[model samples]
Target: MSAASEAETRFEREDTRRRWLLSTPALLIILVAAVGPLLVVLLYSFLAPGSYGDVRWQFSSDAWFNVFLERDIFDDTLAPAWAHLSIFWRSMKLAFITTLLTLVFGFPTAYFIATRDERTREIWLFLITIPFWTNLLIRTFALQEVIRQEGLLNTLLLKLGLISQPIPMLFTDFAIGLGMTYVYLPLMVLPLYASMERIDFRIVEAGYDLYASRFGVLRRIIVPLVKPGIIAGSILVFIPSLGAYVTPRVLGGGKSMMLGNLIELQFGQGRNWPLGAALSIALMAIVMIALLFYVRNASRGGPTHG
Candidate 1:
């Protein structure tokens, strides 16, 4: 072979080897950490729980079957041989509310930050992220303190003569939803800011130059540009909110028992690994379905004007 052809062949071989070498570590880590555990969970989901809380070698569809067609496990403190589809739907509803609230509050804030002067934007972004630097548990506890009966809010309300007694703010659905929105707001905002910041100013200006109304320009130009961010932020907030344990447990008390809390109870207090595994798999399925929908909608390139 000619030297030129030989060199090209050698370079291609080296490039192939280099690519394989670079990708090996990431592939190995994924196999070991993610895929491996998922396989274990899948196996565990099919097995019966032993007397000592270990998995039995015998296989059973009982877990999956119970999750879909049995008595409501969540109806009482004790395990009923049933599925709690209502609880799943309620968690989804709460997650939806939280997502919408986060979007409503986060969008304008992200827009301003994205469109502002660089240094000022940085400062504002830092301020937005400041809450995240603290531990999430600490933040939730702080919220508990603020919203609890006889807490700061109630104290101020009483001092202002707004009410005769402390409002039932803590241990309510509203409080849990509000706390979730607060916790995930930054996740929504940062993505939105990123999407908005990437939008070309001239496209917006051109819309105005063509005599488009402010609303028209926003509807036609801005929405499409930021749709990805909106979807991303929604998914980010919604999925976690659906499976959230701590915020609801702390803020909602017994009133806002999410699937996460239920699953935890099964694994911990209930000592029902089979049910917990089943519930977890169910939750995972819901999240995956939601993600598929989000991806489908996001990929459609946003809303269209009629």
Candidate 2:
């Protein structure tokens, strides 16, 4: 090689080496802080459950099999774990419902904030974020009070004569969905407003000038523009709502068991660490699937509107 080419190659090698050296700390942190626990859980899932809560050294696939199937003690026949299936169904249903509910409420709220003057927008955005200042558990407890019989909601209904007695609102699936929606509404709103804020109002006016009705302008112009935000916000709301523990526990009174609660039950009272590890891996897999779906859609570059 020529002297100049050799010198350039040497410089490139040193630069690459330096970059690796600089990134070593971050790589180590990720390996230890993130990958380590996941590795431990993955290992535990293949092990046998002990008589107590921990796992035995022996390898077993019972935990994984038990994820979807259970053996009936009476006839020694294997059957689908209907209880687990129902809990999984409920989790998915509630998460989807919560996403829809938040979108329904957040789209308009985001538009309102995004359309306001800069100062007013700041105030409105600040109000939207005020919920984040409080701890999640505390916020959940506060929600519990609202839907509890004889609390604000039922009391208002009673005073207004809308109901003869306080409605049985608390400790139900309705309470779970309501709590999740309230908790995740801000997540939906912030992303939507980010997308809406960048919109040019002139295009909307141009659509109107072309004799487009209010709904037409919204359907063709506004939604197409904010599609990215809708996807992001729905993902943000849905993922956490699926894995939620505290909100369901307080609101559902432990009757409405989500996947999170089920996992906890395995590790704690059920004394099935292997099953818990398997469940944890299953939850992680579901999360990865959701992320893959998001990535697939988020990477598609076709224009939402012509």
Candidate 3:
């Protein structure tokens, strides 16, 4: 080989080495922090549960079987764990509701912000992020104050003669839904706004000039264009809502428990680490399945769309 060519090859190899060296710290951190813990959890899911907070090294399938099948001690026959299934279903249902509600509300807010003048947009964006300034627990408690029996909502209703008495709102499924929506609304809006802002106004104007109605224009043009943001926001809202702990604990009154509550109970009061790990894996599987669907849909829709 020519000396010049050899020098070029040496330079290319050095550049590759430099890139890998720069990325090594992040790779190691991920391996330690994320992969390490996940592996431990996976291993625990297959191990026997200990009397205390420990796990036995002996292999067991009890944790996985406990998800759907339960053996009755009295009859020595296997039966369905309907309670666990119900909890999982409830978690999924609540997450779907939260995602749907956020999408319905967030899109309009995002569109309004996207349509604003530059300085006005900045102000609106800043307002959206104000929720992040306060601690989430404090914000959740503030929501509790607003919706409690003697709180602002009831007080206003009483003064207006809208109700004969204070409504029970603090510890219900409705309150949990409301709190989740409030907390995650910003997550949905920002991505949507980003997508909407990138859209060319001329395309919208063109649609209008072609005699498309407002609703029609939005349905066909705007919605399709911003599909990426909708998916992104839905994911941002859905995954967290499914495993939410604090919001449900504060608002759901512990009576309306979701998967996160179940997991917490297993590790804390329930003292069942193996079951908890199995449930965690199950939750992750659900998320992965959803993500797979999203990826498949995105691929089929072509590169231009989400």
lDDT of the candidates, in the order given = 0.86, 0.91, 0.92
Clashing pairs in 2: none
lDDT of 3: 0.92
TM, every model: 0.87, 0.90, 0.94
Candidate 3 C-alpha lDDT tens digits along 159-236: 999999999999988999899999999999999998999888789999999999999899889998898888889888
Off by over 4 Å in 3: 1-13, 302-306
The predicted structure with the larger lDDT, 2 or 3, is: 3
How many backbone clashes does every candidate have? 5, 0, 0
Candidate 1 has an lDDT of 0.86
Q: How well does candidate 2 match the true structure in TM-score terms?
A: 0.90
User: For this target, which candidate reaches the highest TM-score against the unseen true structure?
Assistant: 3
Ranking by lDDT: 3, 2, 1
